[model samples]
Target: MPPPPRRRGSSRGKILDLIRTTGPISRVELAEMTGLTQATISTSVRELLRDGLVSETGRGESTGGKPRTSLEINPAARLGIGLHIGRDYTTYIVADLAGTVVGRLRVAGVGDSEPESAITRMAEDIEQLLDGLDVDRGAIVGVGIATPGPLDRDAGAIMGAPALGAWTGFPLAATLSEATGFTCTFDNDATAAAIGEFWLGATGGYNTYASVYMGAGIGVGIVIDGTIYHGKQANVGELGHITVDAMGPTCACGNVGCVELYAGPQAVIDAAHEAVEHGELDMEFTGRITADFDRIADLALNGDATASAIFARSAEYLAAGIVSMVNLIDVQLVVLAGSAFQTIGSLYARTIAQRLGERAFARAVQTVDVRMSVNGTDAAALGAATLVLQDRLSPRSLASITLA
Candidate 1:
């Protein structure tokens, strides 16, 4: 067998990332942006070109001499998979090297089911999706799984999470890899969404920012200098668990008056059900959290006072938590993502942005930009896939080996 290729340095990954984000770019431009020497950028980009990971799109305007050849990512050169496991639904996405989602699927979540059984079923779904797409298996980099967490990533295990307690200490990465015949990496959904946004250059070039993801729960993902900040135990962002009400009820995570207790999707759904029971809302709901949440949003949009009050209260609490986060981290950008925000994102966005504009400690010095994720409900799933792409194609360090 031929000897494995020598692994290149971090510079290669850095250059590739820049190309994907701001491509049809010249080698000179890369050198300028990265502050790497012209010689170094040439060497790294040459290796990327040789490996079929990058392509020279064409020439650009000449500065003084010969026209410069612009380079861009070869989107077809590689593929990645992202599996987002949420409270009520699971999503799968396939993205090419340029961070564009090529295929997607959604299915029932791990609600009241055995964690092991759920993983097995997801694995089969992945195989079938790939087969249906007729994707070149050899081009597949790997899979990244995003789940609600308070987990141990190095051990590839979930320590524990509410409603997902049965998955505690489960070897999620190993089990998924075993079932799918592909390498797997696991992380919390919020962090994955942040990475996905960063991978797609959605942060408007800010090196530090936070993604406030609302799904079954609320969580924050912090990225500083272009990397996810996995504070001790790889569980840094728990924005939902932050105490928003000192006199409120306790949460499953043992916190008092968490923002999620008042603002999460489940909270909204429960409140809607209570309103219906009390004859406040003259409507029937199917009890599915997402569907019910959407219905409430529609009613609110259509001028239902009760529904508007429910979401407004939720938005108020969520914005308060986010304002606190901004006060603490001072990030200039806060992105709203995940399934919960898919329908009522505008409400949350306006509230959060207003709170930040008015209350953030840095409000005088900087305006924190808050926007909805373009990926919508697919944000976490796409980010999960981006985890694989970033790891394999543009990792910050030398670790992964070239695929055979």
Candidate 2:
């Protein structure tokens, strides 16, 4: 998603940017492509080569002159770790400079646990994960975390994530940094999913898209011109809390009619529990929400009408959210990601696509591509890893760019 269209500003940023976007190319080509003088290109390339960011990858065709040496990124030079602490599970991954995941691990169901205990365990896991890989500790850029948010990203503190109440006000990034001795960066899972999709996902080349992430809650990660829409505190992906029914139950965030209150997995489970309590539907439950949700999803998949209806009702609320998002953002693509979509994803995808086709404001001139993530449920974790790559490899301005 990076290597900006403009090649004149930030010479080193531009050179590395070109190498990333254009693939392996010679100094002559970089100079010609970026419109920078040969001397400037040479200087920048030398610094990059010395820093182990770029490598001479062989040779290129000789255009009536000597064959030029080709250069490309050294993917193994730098490594990054991305972690997502979800309600149902914790996913961790290590990626190299190319944003390719080289290692991964998972711990099931951590949202209800204490933040300090969960993080301490995760730090130990990182140490073990590092030992299995051949990369040096010095080459590690840092750790990137994607958790449910309304967090203070700069302060490394989490706030307002209802499921992570114990994590509220916890110094997440700083704590992880101190425990691991590597710098850490954090962002909401939704934005992280969008970043991962743009950089390493099949959603490549499509700069403007929305990634609807479902976990403990639902969020919309909006990407425009290859850049994520965010600020220092949090992001604009709280579309899950967008009001859909003014009369709906109040959310912990103090909003009534919030989409998550009606359509999130928890909402669906709560509805099912209510149905059971009222004797409207008969279904086995373990008194655990996670297990109950899984049971309901399996029943729906196996042709249980009641279970199917539950998902349908939830999808309706979610579609209302999609409609609002399209009307406001006018995006042509919407991707579904996160654990909530792990089972009945097709139902949501179908409902969203159908609704957009029927009612999206831009449907007349543009069609929305509503689809599920090809990366499966790991979109957020992989995207978390990309955060470190963007911060370490590309200049802040270039990695997230507005292209013409």
Best by lDDT: 1
lDDT of 1: 0.84
TM-score of 2: 0.90
Evaluated with TM-score, which candidate comes out highest? Answer: 1
lDDT of 2 by residue, 93-115 (tens): 89876668899888775657887
Q: Relative to the unseen true structure, what is the C-alpha lDDT of residue 37 in candidate 1, on a scale of 0 to 100? A: 99
Return the lDDT, model 2, position 222.
Answer: 83
Q: After superposition on all CA atoms, what RMSD does each candidate show versus the true structure?
A: 4.7, 4.0
- Candidate 1: minimum summed lDDT over ten consecutive residues — where? 395-404
- What is candidate 1's lDDT per residue for 293-368, written digit by digit as tens? 8888888889999999999999999999999998888898999998788877999999989988999997999999
Candidate 2 collision pairs: 88-109
